[model samples]
Target chain A: MQKIVPNISVDCVIFGFDFKQLNVLLVERKLQDEKTGETLIDDWTLTGYHIFEDEDFDTAAARILKGLSGLDNIYLEQFYAFGKVSRVDSPKDNIWLKHQHEGFSSRIVTVGYYSLIDNSTVTLQLQERNVKWFSITDLPELGFDHQEILNKALEKLRSKLRSEPIGFELLPEKFTLSQLQKLYEAILGTTYDRRNFRKKVLQMKYIIPLNEKQKAVKHKPAQLFIFSRDVYERTKRERFDFSI
Target chain B: MQKIVPNISVDCVIFGFDFKQLNVLLVERKLQDEKTGETLIDDWTLTGYHIFEDEDFDTAAARILKGLSGLDNIYLEQFYAFGKVSRVDSPKDNIWLKHQHEGFSSRIVTVGYYSLIDNSTVTLQLQERNVKWFSITDLPELGFDHQEILNKALEKLRSKLRSEPIGFELLPEKFTLSQLQKLYEAILGTTYDRRNFRKKVLQMKYIIPLNEKQKAVKHKPAQLFIFSRDVYERTKRERFDFSI
Candidate 1:
C-alpha cells in the first residue's frame, strides 16, 4: 500500500460539456445496511481518494479522474477545500460508514477539484464499474457532502466560463458559431440575442473563422470557427474586476 | 474539548493594503532545536488553526482572522488548499514540531485565505502576542510551508486586484490618483504612464471623484476619489476574456 495520509482525501468534480448540455461524472457506490444486513447499491458520489505520502494533490486528483473516467490528459484545477470538521464522520455518517467499511475513526478533510472535459470523447464504461455521467439537470441523490461539492463546481465553472476561453475545452474545437452560442446558453441559462451574440463573437479577434462549413447538415451549411490561443496570449488584459 | 478533526487547519494570508505599501500579517512562532535543546524565537508564521468539528471552513478562517488580527467584518476569500502528504510531519518539519508540541500525527491540509483590509483602521494589538505586520517586500524567514502559502496568496491577490475594485480595501476612503496608481504599481510591480493611468481612471464611471483634496502633505495637494461599489454593481460588464 502506498503511504496514503489518513483522514485526508481529494475529491474531483469532472464537468463534461457538449454543445447541447453540461454534465458531471459521478460514481455509484455500493453499501450495506447495518441493521438489515442487506447490500444497498447505486449511491452516487464524486470520484475521490486519499493521496499517498509521495504524491502531489494535483497528481492524485488526476489519477482519480483517469481511473473513474478511463481517460487521460484533462487538466484538473482545484477549486476549494471542504474542511468542515464533521465532513467525513458524524454519528449519522458513522452508521452509514458501518455499511461501507469495517469501521470509522477520525473525520476526513476533502480538497475539491474541477475540470472541463469533452463529454463526446469519454467512454461509456468506467474502470471501477458503476461510474456514469449524469446530466446537470437530472442529478441523483449523492453521498457525503458531494452535492455541496457539485454545486461549488458548477459555481466555479459558470464563473470561469464567463471570463475565460475554457469554452473550447468542452467543444469539438472546429465548431460552428451556433454551437458556440448553444454551449454558452446551456451553461449560463440565459439566451443571447442572435445578432448581438454574433457581433460580439466576430469582434473577439481570438475566435478565428475558418474556410470550412458544416457538411452533414440538411439546412444551409454554417461557417466554422476555432479559438486562437496565440492571440489570447498576446492580448489578455487586466479588466480590474474579479467578482467570480 | 470540542470535536475537531485531526490534521486539517486553516491559514489566513491577511493582506493589509496601506496606500503606500503592501503588508501581510504574520505571527511570530518560537521553537527549540531538538538536537541542541536551545530555544529559537522569532520565526514568523501566518495565523491559523485546526478547525473545530462544529465550524465550517469559512467560519474557521474568519475566526482565525478575528483572533490574530482582532479585526472582524472583513470578508475573507479562500484562494487555495495546500495538501502534500507529508505537509505536517516530514523529517525536516519534525525537527521544528518538536518544539511546537510533544508530537505531530497524520498530515495537516491547510486551506489558504486572503483578504484586503484597510491597514489604517486596523488596531495593531492582537490576542496572540507577537503578531506583526511586515511589508510584503521585506518578509522574514517564515515557518512551515507558510512562504509557499504566502506566495500563492500573493498570486491570487494580484489576480483579484486586477479584475475587481478591491483597491479601496488597501487605500484610505478619500485618496489621490497618485496614491491609487502607486497601490496598483506596488501590487502589480509595474510602472504606469501617469497620463494614461489618469485617463483610464477618469473613464471609469464608478470611481467617484470627491471635492476633497489631500491634506497635511508637503507637496501640492492632488484631487481625491473613492470607488463606488453601487455604480460598479450596476455597470460591471461580463468582460468575456478571462485570461490573467
Candidate 2:
C-alpha cells in the first residue's frame, strides 16, 4: 500500500513546443460513483497526485510525473501553491475524491510546478500514456481548478522566458531563427517584427550560429543556431534593472 | 479556540533594510517539556504558524504576520514550499510541537513566503513583540528547518532583486543613489563601480531625480532620487532577452 499525504498534492504543468505552437501535457481523469461503480465524469487534469508519506514536494512532483507519463529526469520548478478553500468545491470533484479513498480529505493544498519538455525525445513515451498535449491557445474544460493552475503556469512561463533562456528547453537542439521566433510568439501570444527580433536575438552572444542550414525545404534554408549554456554561464550578468 | 490545519504551515521571512545592511525578522522560541513544564530548549525561528482551517495560504501568512508582529497589508510573495519528511528532525522541534498540541502530527508541508518590511514605519510595532531583526550577515542558530528556509528566502531575494525592482520595497521613499547602491550591495554582497552604477541608473527613466537633498548627514548631502512606479509601468517592455 502506498502511504500518501492526505492533505497535500503536487500538480505539474508540462509544456512542449513543436516548432509552431506550445502545448501542455494533461491526463484524462474518469471519475466514478463509489456505490454504483459507474463512470460519473470524465475530464482533463494536470498530471498530479498526493505526495508519498516520506517524500518531499520536488520528489513527489517528479514521482507523480514519472508514474503518470513515464517522463524521467525532467526538471519541474515549483511556481505556486494553490490552497483556496474552494479549490475542490465542485460536486463531482468532491465526490470523486471521496470515492478514491476511504476517508479522503477534501481540503488539499496543491503545490504547482511548471516543467518544460524537450519534445523530440519525450514524445514517444508520452504517446504511450493516457495523456494528451493541448495547445495553450485551445484548452478543454479542466477539472478541479486545473484551468486556473494551467493559466498561472503559462503566465509564469511567459515571465520566465522574458528573463531566462528557458524557451530553448522546448525547441530542438538545432533550430532556425524563425522557429525560435515562432516558439516565443506562440508562448507569448504576440507577433514580433521579424527583422528586429532577428537582430536582437543575433546580438545575444550565447546563441551561436551553426554552419548549417535546413534540408529538404521548399523555401531558401535559413541558418541554424544553437544555445550555448557555457557561454551563457560565463557572460550572464547579475543585473538589477528598473524594469518593473 | 482556534482551528488550524495540522499538516500545513506557512512561514514568512520578513526582510528589512536599515540603510547599511539587510536584516530579517525572527522570533525567539522557548520550548518546554510537556510533563515537567521546564524550558528544554531556546532558539530563534522564522515567524510562522500552522494555517487556520478555513484560510488560504496567503490569508494564513498575512494572518500569522499580523498576529505575531502587528504588520498589516505587507505583501508576501510565496517563494517556495518546503515539505521534507524530516523538516522537524530536531528532537527539540518535535518536542515543542508535541507540547503545543495534543496528538500533533510532525509531517508538515510549509509554504514559505518572503516579505519585505519598510522598516521606518513597522519598526515601532515590531519593538513591542518578541520579534527582532537580525542582520543577514550575522544570524542566530535557527530552529526546525528554518535556517534552510531563511537561506532559500535570501537566495530568492537576491535573484528577485537581480531582475525585478523589489529593492525599492527595502528602501526609503526618498533615497540617494549611494543609498540605492548600498541597498543592492548589502543584499547582493558585492560592490559595484560607482561611476558605472550611477550611469546605468541615471539612464533608467523610471528612477527620477528629485529636487530634494539629504539633510543632517555626517558627509556631504547627496542628491535624492525616487523610484517612479508610474514611469516604470508606462515604459516597461515585454521583451525577452537571452541573458542566460
Candidate 3:
C-alpha cells in the first residue's frame, strides 16, 4: 500500500570571471524526442541530472560537477527549484508518462545550484557532445527557464560579490586592483568611479597589498593585492553589510 | 553533434502556521528499489518532480501544487538549487554512474521552491500515500538532506515574515488579534509580552479593527481584526527593520 515517489533532479549554472567578462558553463542536450527524433537545439544549457532515491541533492550536484568538468570539492550553492507541471514537452503524449506508472502524470522538479570556479582549471570531460563556456552577456536562447535561472544566479552573484569573498573563487589567486574593479563592473553591469571603488576597497582593510606588479600592460602597472587571510577568516563568521 | 541535457526538477516545502506551531507538508515515497526488492525504508521526504523538457521550473512548481494539493495560483518563491555529487543514495552505484551509458548518468539538478499557504484552505489530494503535516520543531527523521532544506526554508520564511504580511496567508480571512498574535508567536517561536506584542502590532497600522468579536471563547471574547489591505500592500514594498 505504498505510494510511488516522483523523480528528483539537480541542475547547475557555473559562473567564472576572467577579468574581462563573466561566463557560464553550458552543455548541449543529446537526447531527442522519441516521436520527432530532432537532435538539434537552438543553444546549449547548463549541466543537470536526476536524483537517486538514496542520494542527497547536494551529493547529486557534486557528482554532476565532477562527471562533467572533472572538478571536485568546489563550492556549489543551491539557488532555486522549478516544479511546474507540463515543464517537459515531448511530441507524444503518455510516452514518457508510461515510464513512471504511478498515477502521477509526467512532471519534473529541477533544483538550480551555482558555483564560482577558475574556468581555466576546468578540464572538460566532454562526455556527451559539446561543453563550452558562454559569455553571460551574449548567451544564446537557452532551453527551459534556464535563462531565468541564469539571471537569478547572476543577481545573487552580484549581490554576494559586494558582501562576500566569492569573487576570489572566480579570479586567479593573484590579481590587480584594476582587474578587481573590472570584475565588479562586469558583475554590476555599470561603470564605477575608479577612485571611489579603490577607496572603498582600501577602507575595508582586507585587501592585503602584495609586493608584486603586473608584468605586461599598456598603462601603468598596478600593484597586486591578495585577499587578506586574516580578515577573510575573521569575516567568515561575521555577516557582511555592503550597503554603500 | 548535439549535446545531451540532464533533466531538471523542483521541490517545494509548503510552510503553514497554525497559530502555535510551524508546519510543513511531507509525502512518503512509494517506489521500491528495482534491485533490492525491499519494501519502504524509513525515508519520508518532500514532494518533488522533474522539469519537463519543454517547460520552465516555476511553471512546473505550480503544476505540482495543483496536482498534489489541489491549490492553484498560490504565491511560490524559488529558494535554492541542490547539486552535489552524493545527494542521491540508491542501492545502485551512484544512480547516474550506473546509467552512465544512457547519457542519464549525467548529474540532475533540482530547484527548491517554497510557498506559504493557509492550511485551512488546503484540501489534500489523497492521490498519494500519506499527506500529513508535521511541526517543524518535532519533525521525524527525513530522507536525504531534506531536514537541512526545511531548515533553510524556515530561515527564509522567518526573515520574510518579519518584513511582510506573510502571517495573513496562514490566518483565516477574518481573524482575531489574538489569533494573529498567535501566528506571530508560532513563526517567531518565542514568547512575547502580550502588551508589547499588541503595542507593536497596533503601531504598524496594518491590522484593521473590525466591529466584530470572537464567538464562544472560554475567556473574554477578543475583538476581530482584518488585515488592512492598503497598509499591508504598501508596507510589503517598503522594507521594515526586523533585527529584533
Per-candidate DockQ values are: 0.49, 0.55, 0.14
| Interface CA root-mean-square deviation for model 3 | 8.2
Best by DockQ: 2
lDDT by residue for model 3 over A145-243, one digit each (tens)? 677778878866664554456676777778888888887777778777889877777765667888899887898888888876577666543221111
Task: Write one digit per residue (lDDT tens) for candidate 1, span B1-244.
Answer: 6766556688999888777788998888766666997776547888888777677889988888887657788868899999776665545466656655733355667889987788887886655467788999999988788899999999887877777778777777888898888889889887899998888888888888998888888989999898888888988765455543
Select the stronger candidate by TM-score from 1 and 2. Answer: 2
lDDT of 2 by residue, A20-133 (tens): 789998888786666899889788888888888988888988877776557788868888899998898897787667667655576888999988877766743454436888
Candidate 1 chain A weakest lDDT stretch, 10 residues: A98-107
Ranking by lDDT: 2, 1, 3
Mark the regions of model 3 whose C-alpha exceeds 4 Å error after superposition.
Answer: A1-10, A27-42, A48-60, A63-70, A83-110, A122-131, A143-149, A155-164, A203-207, A228-233, A236-244, B1-12, B17-73, B78-113, B118-146, B158-244
How much DockQ does model 3 earn?
0.14
Reference contacts recovered by each candidate, as fractions? 0.75, 0.72, 0.25
Model 1 stretches with alpha carbons more than 4 Å out: A3-6, A29-43, A87-95, A102-106, A127-129, A193-214, A220-231, A241-244, B1-5, B28-43, B87-92, B126-131, B172-178, B191-215, B218-237
Whole-model Cα lDDT of every candidate shown, in order = 0.79, 0.84, 0.69
Candidate 2, Cα interface RMSD: 2.6
Q: TM-score of the candidate numbered 1?
A: 0.82
Candidate 1, residues A117-227, lDDT tens digits: the string is 888888755455587788898999888889989999888777777777887888777888898888888888778989998888888788999999999889999999999
Highest lDDT among the candidates is held by which one?
Answer: 2
